[model samples]
Target: MTDRVLSGCRIIIVEDDYYQAHDCKQMLQQAGAKVVAVTAIVPDLPDLLAEGRIDAALIDINLGHSHTFDFARELQARSIPFAFLTGYDAGMLPDDLATNVCISKPADLHRVVSVIAGLASRGG
Candidate 1:
């Protein structure tokens, strides 16, 4: 495992499901990415963004109480890139966002590493 590949990459995770968030964070941390924050709600997102530099994000399409598109827009406004991590199928995503890359739930650690590497390569 290369520790420096994702060095200094700040990743934000938004998932209402606590276990999933924990698991994802562990995977990301193991890959050498610094997880800035893991939040289950969007109201806290702006604050998190304000507090640090976010290079990329792993956002769940649906929080327990709401969807993440609005938060995605916020990230877009900041020119930060993000990928969706969802249990829901691609069909569940809005057409506009369906083109965005996503990792299905029960994501493989290696695949997650590869995806993050790809995102990093794109300067995400």
Candidate 2:
């Protein structure tokens, strides 16, 4: 294990799967991110964003029965930097979101740390 690089940054996780969410949280926390909240859907997302503390987000491409593209749209509108963390392959992502940073599930913790480091460095 390495020292946490994202020591003070706030992260929000949007994953519907309980085990996946737990894994993500553990990884981020290990990397020193302050995980403000984790949610399974977009309906409560706006409220969470309104709290004005999230530095970035790691979002699952699908949230149970719902796709997270709409949530991604909202994040874009707010100018929040986010990355897709999905079990699905990159080819499964929508055409419009193809350019966003994405990490395959069973993600490499170092890569995830680097991604968050870049986001934080960019003032996300």
Candidate 3:
């Protein structure tokens, strides 16, 4: 039962955990999104973004030694919509970033797909 909720959307996943990244990529693909890239390294994002159009991004807060706050700001500067898909609570993020959509880990695929669809549709 593919919902196709994210049909035609191009997305990137940035998560440090291999299994988590894989699961998210698979789920997004199943939901009719193009999983442009699944990367654990934050520094690889610029190269990946340059490769093609990305409708939205699912970023993890803590990528082991680094964080995605800077990248998130970059995305904002680009006017690209993105959401944090992290295990950490939304309240923990800096005040400016806390307002962005944040989905908890072990999330329901349906909810993930729904939120992504909304974000992508919002000029992403």
Candidate lDDT (C-alpha), each: 0.79, 0.82, 0.85
lDDT score for candidate 2 against the true structure:
0.82
Which candidate order results from sorting by lDDT in descending order? 3, 2, 1
The predicted structure with the larger TM-score, 1 or 3, is 3
Best by lDDT: 3
- Give the TM-scores of the predictions, in the order they appear: 0.87, 0.87, 0.92
Off by over 4 Å in 3: none
Pairs of residues at least 3 apart in sequence or in different chains that clash in candidate 1: none
Mind sharing the TM-score for model 3?
0.92
Best by TM-score: 3
lDDT of 1 by residue, 20-111 (tens): 88987887887889999888877566677688777788898988788998877777667777889888887877776777788998777677
Tens digits of per-residue lDDT for model 2 on 4-110?
78899898988887887787788889889999888887656668857766788889998779899988887777777889988888888778778789998877867
